[model samples]
Target: MDSIQRKKLVNELISLIEKGNAHVSFKESVTGLPSELRTIIPENLPYSIWQLVEHIRIAQKDIVDFSSSAGSESLAWPDDYWVEPTDTVTDEDWNNSLQQIEKDQQRFQALLEDEQHDLFAPLPWGTGQSLLREAMLIADHNAYHTAEIVVARRLLKSWK
Candidate 1:
C-alpha cells in the first residue's frame, strides 16, 4: 500500500485495538468489573473472567514480542499463552494483567505508527509474518476473548 493507505490502515487498526469502534471495545468489556467477579466461573464455561483476561494479556504480549526484531523463537502455545484457572485470584493480578494489555496495545500501535518501519515486511525472525499481520491478529484475538469476558460477566449478572 502507499503511504497514505498505510497510515489509514494503521489508524483504523489502532482504533480497533483501543475502542473496538464497530463492536464492543475491550475497555467496554472489562471496565467497571467488580474484583470479586473477576474469578467467577459461570456454569459450563471452561475459564473464568480472570483466566480470559490473563490469556488475552499473555497472547497480546506474545504478538507484540514477535512483531519486534528481538522476539523469541520458541514460544509454547497453550502452555505459554494461558494461566491456570483459580478460585482465588488477587486484585493485583487482575490489575496487572489489564495494565499489561494496555501497555502492549500501545506498543503495537507504536510499531504501526513508526514511519521508518515497513509494516508489510516480514520480521527477520519469522518465516512469513509482517507487523501488519500481527497487529490484525492481536485485534482479532482480543476482540474474541473480550467478547467471552463480556458474555461471562453477563451470565453471572456482574455486567451492568
Candidate 2:
C-alpha cells in the first residue's frame, strides 16, 4: 500500500484502540460503577485478571517479536497461566500486571514509525498479514475483553 494510505489506516486503528482503553481502565467516563470492582478478575475463577493480563501481554510481546524476527510463535502457557487468585494475590501483583500491559501497549505503538508504519504488510515470518493488521487484531482483542470485564462486573455486582 502507498504511504498515505497506510498512514490513514494506522490512524484509524489507533483511534479504535484508544476507545477500547477507555473502557478497560478508565471507568470515570461511565456514570458510575456497580459498587465493587477489582482491577483484576475475582478470586473464584481459575484465572484472575492478572493471569489473563500476563497471557495477553505475552501474546503481544510475541507478535512484536515475530514481526521483527519472523516465524516465531508463542511458547506453551506456564502452569501459572491457568491459575486464579491462589488465596493471596497482593496489590502489587495486580499493579505489576497492569503495568506490564501498559508497557506492552507502548511497545506495540512504538513499532509504528514515520515510514511505512501504517500499511498491513505481510509478516516477515508468518503465513500472511501486515504488521498493522496484527496490531489491529490486538487492539480489537483488548477492547473486546475490556467490554467483557465491564459486563461481567455489572453482572456480578463487582463494580464499585
**TM-score for all predictions?**
0.93, 0.69
What is candidate 2's CA lDDT for residue 52? 49
Q: Write the per-residue lDDT of candidate 2 for residues 2-83, one digit (tens) a residue.
A: 7777677667666665556445542221225322244345545434444445556666566666665655665665652334
* Alpha-carbon RMSD of each model: 1.4, 4.5
lDDT of 2 at 3: 74
* Clashes by residue pair, model 1: none
**Over 4 Å off, model 2:** 1-4, 21-47, 71-73, 77-85, 114-118
Best by lDDT: 1
Q: What lDDT tens digits, residue by residue, belong to model 1 across residues 1-160? A: 7889989988998998888777888888988888888888899998898889889998888888878667556568779877887888787877787889999999888999998878889888888899888978988898899889989998989777
What lDDT is reached at residue 23 by model 1?
80
lDDT at 151 for candidate 2? 58
Clashing residue pairs in candidate 2 are: 34-159, 35-159, 35-160, 36-158, 36-159, 36-160, 41-49, 71-125, 120-130, 121-130
What is the TM-score (0 to 1) of candidate 1? 0.93
